[model samples]
Target: MGEKLIYMDHAATTYVKPQVVEAMLPFFTEKFGNASSIYTIGRESKKAIEESREKVSDAIGAQAREIFFTGSGTEADNWAIKGVAYANKSKGNHIITTNIEHHAVLHTCQYLENDGFEVTYLPVDENGLVTPQQVADAIKPNTILITIMFANNEIGTIQPIAEIGAIAKEKGIYFHTDAVQAIGNIAINVKDMNIDLMSMSAHKFYGPKGVGALYVRKGVKLVSFIHGGAQERGRRASTENIPAIVGFGKAIELATANLDEYNKKIMALRDRTIDEITKKIPFVKLNGHREKRLPGNVNLSFQFIEGESLLLMLDMKGIAASSGSACTSGSLDPSHVLLAIGLPHEIAHGSLRLTFGDENTDEDVNKLLEVLPVIVERLREMSPLYENVKRGNKNV
Candidate 1:
């Protein structure tokens, strides 16, 4: 048998499911048509779009008309934040979000600040949790919108989204959540959560990349972020991506159908991996709340090691993992999420995220549990920081 390549980077992206590919194949060839044209082929494409919209909406317990396809989760996030910010600018210039939000929401908020909007970035606890009380405290008369993520991308800390949403509703402020990481892993209901706007990406689930959606609650007004055609009810404009939309719809169906079973199985492996890694590796710390995180997430920080060096070593062993958010991997900075949760810069620099997927088995977990301790030990021996610590040099 060939050597196994354990892929543990599901948080970064998941492989497209075979079912999803089968669902999308016909659309790419025989059914190829612009969703905009009024001809027969075009009508078929339009029908597929609407069907996909319903599937996605149903998965999230949202209405069919509320779903609008976008090019990516980032686009959905940008449109949700900037669209709401600009539309409600007359209502108030203040917005509230957490300090640990994904860059899509964070950068958009920063851009709005340049346009004279006031934003309050709430801090998280050491467990990477933002309390409802903290959000309630941040509310002001001028606060118009509150956008927080459903779950953290790097640490996998599931936020109190419904609680925050309730606070936003009671204050009459629009609530939006970047659910890119949370969509397929947990249940989401826009109505129960009191969410006015939300974002999702297909790639996070077992679907194709470069396709995502924004959920706008009916009666919530959003300014158009993209303008050209009448597609997406004139709110978002572009020719709809038909094949990817079909794959997204099918993927959501599969993910929803098997969510409970998948979570139960994956969480077992995840917990076992966490326990073994922490017990075997001294000076290793797990990030995020122990119980209040995604089932597949296992984030850890190894002392006296650089995360990139660790990733390279793991790659040589044919295991795939991540140091931080793939979006910011090329950057030199330590994860903002880790630093926000009280990890010292040096400690944060050694963080690793081994997010599991449906395909990850106990054997894979065992392989990691076996290899990781050895890698960390080897790395620490070569680490100058470890040497300093060993020599009783506290100043370093």
Candidate 2:
């Protein structure tokens, strides 16, 4: 194994920042009081929760009252889709979304379909983009919601969110985006974008895991998700996870404050890695938009090699990366996002996703470039498909 570890899977989740940890430590022990209580320690906890809410709202151009904390991005997504569906079912039963959304969105939509909701799973172009026109055209009179992801977790393709949001607004439909992968990476204004609902995860942005938030625009009709307490302004119920919430707030504040510098540094490393890998490796295909992708995302497919093999090989070389979303890593199927963008089953099965972050340096990129080509070459040499092609077997 290589002496140093190179972590390049920020799209899955991020390590909690030290500053966020410091802010959260007090809530865990020193101020270990239930936020719902009315006593002194409880009041302090409540105050901390509200302050964190304000920080989250400020980071995303939302009103503090709009942010409701949840257990995870998956929970937020489930709530957003189901809440809007049930609340507005009398008016509409149709929801439109792209085919390449994360399983958090896709599976929720599927579950809604089982509950008698109609969904239009729109297809994306080869570059994994859904146009505003596709959204505008898919709208039916009964279309209650349009839920698309802000950015793809696998291929890292950013959607035309503003345009789609505007179309939904003009059509008088609610819009929701799973911004779990986009919260800290992209600048977003829910009001300006006409987004009625959005979901975010703390772990995606250097905050604690198991805590997330849903932004519900004022006056949007959404039924309560959890039903036990008066917490989250009666929208979501449960005792609040104050420590993680505080960490989330601190992390978002820091991330948005340093967004520009973070992008610049990470993008340089990403581009260099992409350029070097493609230049050095054979039969490589770059996934997602060449330009309109997340700054630190580098997705590629090496022909005649399995993505799992590549990932394991890279791991042995001290590079921690992913074949696709970490949530689906255990699955043997090819990435749905790659297939949505027209990649064949074989090529899609060979996809690799390496997302950069603030801590990744040029040395990390150099090490990857040096080790990756050798790994791919070695893997392909063992591949019968490449051997067949080498022997002029065109049918392969």
Candidate 3:
């Protein structure tokens, strides 16, 4: 706690930018009227919502009418999967998705399975990449949708989304990508990629939390995930979160406008940190693709130590990171994303996710590198597993 806190968990969420906050202020106070109302203030709020829609659509090359706002990325994901499934039940009853998907998509697929929809869980390669060929092979006549994440949240592996989308297009199946992590970090053209549906979150890119958008291609019929009012063109029913939506739009504008500069700076710092840690540490393995991954993502596993212990030690040093071993179930289950990429339970148990962001710098990386090895060594010294390896007693 003595060290200045270094936040390397941008993948979890990002701090809202000042510009975004400024843009949202009007919606929260002065222009605070329900978009559903017909009064002057309501009309103004409604107009702002539409403008935000257009900005989001233009950023992703989608039609403004096709953008549906939701409370969160998970909501959008559930809507896309279940909406397509229910809407196209007569056409098909099977959906295909990867095992590495976030719990939002994975759990929805599981729920669909219980409701009598067949689901094909595709596997990934050693680098956590799902191949288009595997997706193609998994398709059946009853396959109605394919939902794969654009980039893995934990491992930062970019999937072959374009290839998979093309295959789905050729086969007349809907393709949906949860691009929550990929939206700010990479360029996504829905039309160019032939994606039928895509989901994005605001908080992942310096926007306010609890606001997200789903892109549904024109002419794609889907049942409503939320049924009540005409908001989101009746696709989703809820009063528009005006302030958060405005903030989301501003955040996107800023992120895209400064994408190149941010990429260069963050990538440089991230790579330096990775290089330093790997060069100085023992038996460390880098997870995910080296070159084809996100600019600010660095995931690694240090053998002979538990991920929770490492995370706790890092916390003591005021280095904020995440480990795959921490779970909502309160069980030390290995991250499903890590295991899907072919890591053994022990290796996956030691996984660390260090996602960089705008505020990070070379000095921060140097500080992390300075403290990390000592922490790892201290933990390994108490680890019976490490002692056995050092003594040439290989038995577990």
Clashes of each: 0, 0, 0
Model 3, residue 9: distance off in Å is 0.2
When 1 and 3 are scored with lDDT, the better candidate is 1
lDDT of 3 by residue, 1-396 (tens): 477999998998899988999999998888999999999999999999999998899899998999988999999999999999999999989999989898999999999999999999988888999889999999998899999999988888898888988999999999999999999999889999999999999999999999999999998879998888888777788788999999888888888877888899999987887898899997899999998899999999989889888888898988999884222324578888888888899988998899999999888888899889999999889888899888985544
What lDDT, from 0 to 1, does candidate 1 have?
0.93
Quick one: ranking by TM-score, best first?
2, 1, 3
C-alpha local distance difference test of each model: 0.93, 0.92, 0.90
**Number of the top TM-score candidate:** 2
Per-residue lDDT of 1-396 in model 1, one digit per residue for the tens? Answer: 255799999999999999999999989898998988889999999999999999999999999999999999999999998888888888999999999999999999999999999999999999999999999999998998999999999999999999999999998999999999999999889999999999999999999999999999998868999899999988888888899999999999888887899899989988998898888987889999999999899999998989999999898888999998999999889999999999999999999999999999888988887888889999999988788777885534
lDDT of 2 by residue, 251-322 (tens): 999999989888989889888888888888778999999888998899998899999999998999899999
Best candidate, lDDT: 1
